[model samples]
Target chain A: MAELTYREALRRALDEELERDDRVFLMGEEIGRFEGSYKVTAGLWAKYGPKRVRETPISEEGFVGAGIGAAMLGLRPVVEIMTINFILVAQDMVVNHAAKIRYMFGGKVGVPMVIRTPGGAGAQLTAQHSQSLEVWFAHVPGLKVVAPSNPADAYGLLKSAIRDDDPVLFVENLVLYNVTGSVPEPEEDFTLPLGRAHVAREGTDLTIVAHSYTVRRALAVADRLAQSGFEAEVVDLRTLRPLDVDTVVESVRKTNRVLIAEEGWATYGVGAELAARIGRACFDDLDAPPERVAGAEVPMPYAKPLELAALALEDKVEAAARSLLAECGLVGSA
Target chain B: MARAVDEVHDVLQDGEQALRLLRLMLLIRRFEERAEEQYTRARIGGYLHLAIGEEAANVGSIDCLGPDDYLFTSYRDHAAALAVGSSPAAVMAELFGKVTGVARGYGGSMHLLDVDRRFLGGWGIVGGHLPIAVGAALALDYRDVAGAVLCQFGDGATNIGAFHEALNLAAVWSLPIVFQVINNLYGMGTSVEQSSAEPELYKRACAYRMHGERVDGNDLLAVREAAGRLLTRAREESRPALLETTTYRFRGHSVADAGKAYRTAEELASWRERDPIARYAGLLREHDLLDDGQLESMRKEVADEVSEAIREAAAAPAPDLGGLYENVYGDERWREQFERMDTAAPFGERMETRSWQS
Candidate 1:
């Protein structure tokens, strides 16, 4: 096993998939010669040449739609949208065309394409550049949405997404790119399955549910709570669309209390959906109502302190966990 | 199997292939006339956009496509579907929303697709499918596949951002695709001139550094020749181009409209006088390729076929409600995994068969 940065792991997945399948090609703005805006696709252009690692203009709608069309014709086109903010321009293509093509055509063809974009808010990159929009894609039925919490999942999930027969929205977080985690050796062909969640930490006192970057914050928050004698479990929801509710419900039953944490807005967000589902699935097992810790309702501000305050950081998650425990009388008084 | 209808006979000195093309056009015209009647009788529901007077543009352009090449069109797709050799009965059943329809009742009048025939789709969204067509071209190029894409759209689609994006990408990538703008004068009620700054839509290709041309869409032979040339160049050289087929729509945007507010009777009459079928039949008569008897027999055959399609479509059964949620995702495993999330409240139950086999 070797520790690799999330960015390196992603690049390795792309390199391996490109080498493994001639049909798998990259298409996006700044993905080839520009080495990607986040440098996640660094050196791919030199390695695979322009055809496999194709560079596109700032035309998200055009290129994204093209990726769907290419996929329909039996090419696996992994398209990068620079960031989730730019994905809006191509929303019609993704939802209307790619997602609906399979069903509307009565299963004649499938869009075996992947739309990879990063959506998180740690950097002080104003309102537009920094916003978590994975929930938007998750709300869409035809799309498979996955957000990996670490490098290993990042590598495995991306490879699986490329090989998937249906359209997938691979959501990446800008802030999680440099985080390090141990990945399996190249000789060991590793791929995580979609529509499944993993329990990152095992505990019985409380279940802290999260996905993507929030999983890291939840683990850290769990560690802080453990210091004060609260053994909180963490459930990493790897796939958001075909959500692994069974896993979340299992953790809730074990803990009898839950706190949902997310890096997006709480209202009508991933947390809202999870909370409602948990309320039904873990109705009798719950010691208290499921609580949620999420990013501030306002659009992300540019100021560093304001940005940090707006984020769903470890402190906010810890606070939400502490309140859930207090409400259940598992710790101190509310 | 034949690349173009013209190539079927190097010495159509006899005009057998020409007569076949005429028969196909006649079938579409009669099919559309019956479809209008069906709509009036409340057999077909939803928005019905017909390609009534655009038969020459539809049939002529499609006659140029090789079997391997792909075709995509906008919602005015009954003629396009017929020209592409889709089952007339199946297409009519689709308009009737029956289970035996081309799309199995999933896609009504607008979203027709036949993957077996390489007709990619009958997209309801105008200009949205342009980039998709370019992507198909990209796929063919990547795989070294021996085929190209033919994307047909209306005049108003030329003014959209996707039109520019799709053409520009096709040019930059050197993808093999021939974009056909069947400029039937108006998109819904907006005329091409009032809607597009560059009403001469083929010239819009100059912005992308691609070849562009316009043809008299009412001239069947002219349309076929121009389309065949552009498509051949696309397949052989990976050169994308724009072919503007200037025609007119005899009906309104949809079946609901009377098609009179924006157009005058005089304009309509003048265009009708230059009817493509009549014009082609006149040419055939002049060359002694077809006689009055042959023409009358062909019309009678097409009318009979149209009547049979309507009869079959009306008799076709409705789609099975048990399979309502099929194909929402390509994988059935997704349904099994997500079934737990289906709430039990009113209107919250997922529309999936508990056991489709039973």
Candidate 2:
């Protein structure tokens, strides 16, 4: 096993799924001959041919609907929208049809489909390109939303998404693509369970709960805090919809303080949800009120400085951690 | 045994089948009339979308389908469901919100599902069932099934995003599906002319690069002829087609609507004059297919059958409370798993052990 970038691991997951199941295929804009918009399906077309690694026309609604139809007929279709923002075009197919089919039919049928897309801001892709919609999908009942922060988890989660018996919304952060980690060699049957959070780093003073790119930011802040003698635990909430609040509550109970982080706008984002749930579940255990480090409320700005200001960077997360420490009466001692 | 196109037409024009279509249409008209009465009395809950004047369109289009063919429709689905072989008792029970109803009383007037009859569902949202119908057609083609899907929606749905997406996919893949648009002119309160750029709804099908046909929906024979041809083409060639049946709804959109706000009383009278049942009865007499006595006897027979069904459905028991959580998840174990997780160790217990270390 060798370290693979987030994009490379996603490619490996698609490659393995395609090889293992003849029915499994990838369809999206520029997925075939052009590799992928982000190279997540770079060499898959060459390996699997046009039929399996399909290059669809730029009709998100059409292709996404077709993928759902294909999945209904027992085909394992992996539909990729270039980004989460583009998925809004196919909201009817995703929310109304794919999410409601199994229940509406009295469980007679199931839509075993997967929609893969990149999300969040940091690359300065501007307003239209960089919105975080995990909370929107999470609000929906039937959809299983997963946002993987690193290469290993991306590989594991995508494989599981393709194989699951329900529709899965698999979101990858655009900025995490080049960052690498050790990915196991492709196996015939490899799948990570959905609705589980991983403890990326363990500490005692405060628990940092985050998903996608914010997981990395939280970990970096934890590293910096470690140097200053404050032990900050980090929890990577891989799946946003089926929030693994038990793991979060457990971490908070041990740490006694919490810092929630997300790349979405500050109001009503995933971080807001995490903080609310923590307050409800472990109210008595809290040493301090939960702190949230989130992106600015404005539409993601184009100018570099504005974009930088709009995002909750490592410094903000670090400051939030220090604030939590201050409330816990550990800042001066640390 | 592949038959010639002409032979298929000849087979469809049998005396028995013709009578069956007429009977089905008559039954639907009477059933809807009864439903309207029930809705007026406040017996039926939720929206009661009546498919009154559009009987010919539903009967003619559904008559072209085989037993294996799938059918999905919008909320105005009582006629469509009946034509697809769902028992009148079950449909009436569904309207009554009884447990013996289709979907076990879960889905009310808008969402009727009968998997056994291949009646997919009556989706509540306009244009919502379009993509689902396309998906079902794709499933049929992938499984090598020799059937097509008839997706019924109103003219209003033509403007929605799902309609464009579903139709485009159907065209691209050549999926075996028929987009049956019952153009009764109004989507809720908005007229087709006001909502759409093109007054001819059939022409919108051309945008998806699929074959489109406009039939006089008031004429059952014409609707049957066009539907039969297109459905045959869909089954044999795996091509999608859109068949718009231009008709009018004699009643308002729902029972509560007077339909007077949007349409003139004279216009409503004009459509009522071209009622599918009355028009077909006149045609049968003109062709010496049936006399007045036969038609009258047939009407009485249908009325009796509808009455019996209503009585039975009224007596049917309500759904059991224990079955509430039955079909929420695919696996039964999710209930146990959710329960176990809900009752797991409280945060207080875990915090006590860590307090000593602190």
Candidate 3:
């Protein structure tokens, strides 16, 4: 194992995928020679040459659609949007074409494309750059949405996404890029299965389900809960669309209480989907109704205080978990 | 008239191809006319945009393409679909929303797809398919294939964000995609002059540092020649080009409207005089390429073919209800999941309970 930052792990995954498969390539603004807008593709152009590492103009819709077209022709294209905000320009291609092609064509073709974009709010990038639009993509049927919370999962899930036959929306949190973790040693061929959740920690009192940046927050909250004599299990949902509801339901069955955390707005977000699924699969297993600690329902405010209040933090997760435990009559007075 | 004679002399292939172009234009015109009648009779549902007056533009531009080349167009696409060799019957079946339709009636008039014929689709949203076409060109170039993408859109799309994005990407990548603008004067109700800052749509291609040309859309010979040259250049050199065919639409944006809200009777009559089929037929007679009898027979044959297709499509059954859950994913696991869901109590009960309050 080698320690790597989230961004470096992503770059390493791209390099390894390109090396392993000649058909795999990367295209986006500033991804070649100039590195990347976030430096996630630094040194890739020099290593693979311009043919594999392509630099596109600031035409998100065009390049994204072009990626789909290339995918249709059996090329695996990893398209990088600078941020989730710029992705709006290409939503029609992502939502209408990439998401519906397989279904509309009756499985005649597959979109083996990975659209990677940095998402979530925290970097003082203001409202436009900070919105979490993963739910919008997750709502689409034919597409897969994956969000990796750390370095290892970033490398693992990205390789899986590149090799997968379906279009995958690989979301990265801007705040987690510099965070470091041990990644598997570089290999010519490496892939991790998609739609599987990883149990960050095993506990018996309550199950905390989260993804991306929220997963880190949940881990922190779980640690804090342990200090308070409460054991909280944390499940990091690396892939959102396929959801791995079985793992989540199994965890809920073991714990009998669940708390869903997401960085997006509370209503109709990932949390709502998880809550509904848990309600369906583990309604009897649940000791209390599933609680969701999600970002407040509004555009991310610019003010620091309001922004802090809007996001789903460790405090919110801990509080929601405590309330669930109390409702289940499992926790004594705090 | 002399220019017309000169263009005809330049590209006319034994006069049969000219007759073919005239025949195709007439077929599209009559097919759309019949579609209009069906829409009025409520046999066709949803938005029914016609290409009645713009048949020459569609046929002329498509005539330039090789069999391996691809074609993409906007919603008003009956003529383009036919010109690219989609059977008139399939086109009619599509308008009638039959399961035998090109896209199994799921596409209706706006979305038409024939992958084998290399006709990508007729996208409903303005300027939406432009980028996808450029992408297809990119794919062709990546595979080292000698083909270009003929992407047709209306004048209104020129001002949209997708037009700029697609053109810029195509120019930067030097992809073999020809951006064909069939400027039918109005974008639904909005005129070109009103929507676009630059009314000369062809000139906008220069902004992307790509080649551009303007041709008289009613002049089928000119459109074919220009498109042929541009497509050749694109296929040979892997370069992007834009061709603006200044055409007119005889009908309203759709079947419901009489098209009176936008233009005057005199304007309509003047455009009608430049009818692509009539003009091309007149040229064929002038050159002794086609006689009145042959033209009449060609029209009758095309009409009969379309009628037969309609009859067959009407007899075809609707798509199987089981297909509602089909094609959502490529994996068998997903199919199994869908099957499990189908077997579960219907989604109505579960969905009703989870419906968003807002």
Best by TM-score: 1
Tell me chain A's TM-score in each of the predictions. 0.98, 0.97, 0.97
lDDT of 1 by residue, B171-198 (tens): 9999889999999899888898899888
Tens-digit lDDT track of model 2 for B57-116: 998888778765888899999998899888888889888878878766767788787777
| Tens digits of per-residue lDDT for model 3, A202-299 | 99889999999999999998888888788889999888877777778889899888999988886888778788878878878988888988878877
How far off is residue A319 in model 3, in Å? 2.0
What TM-score does structure 1 among the candidates reach? 0.96
Each predicted model: what fraction of the native A–B Cα contacts (within 8 Å) does it retain?
0.70, 0.30, 0.42
RMSD of model 1 against the true structure: 2.3
By summed lDDT, the worst window of 10 consecutive residues in model 2 chain B runs over B336-345
| TM-score for predicted model 2 compared with the true structure | 0.92
DockQ score of the complex predicted as candidate 2: 0.41
Which of 1 and 2 is ahead in DockQ?
1
Cα-based lDDT at residue B121, candidate 1: 85
True-vs-predicted CA distance for residue B252, candidate 1, Å? 0.6
Per-residue alpha-carbon lDDT of model 3 for B215-296, expressed as tens digits?
Answer: 9999988888788878888988899999999988898988777888988999999999998888888887888888878988
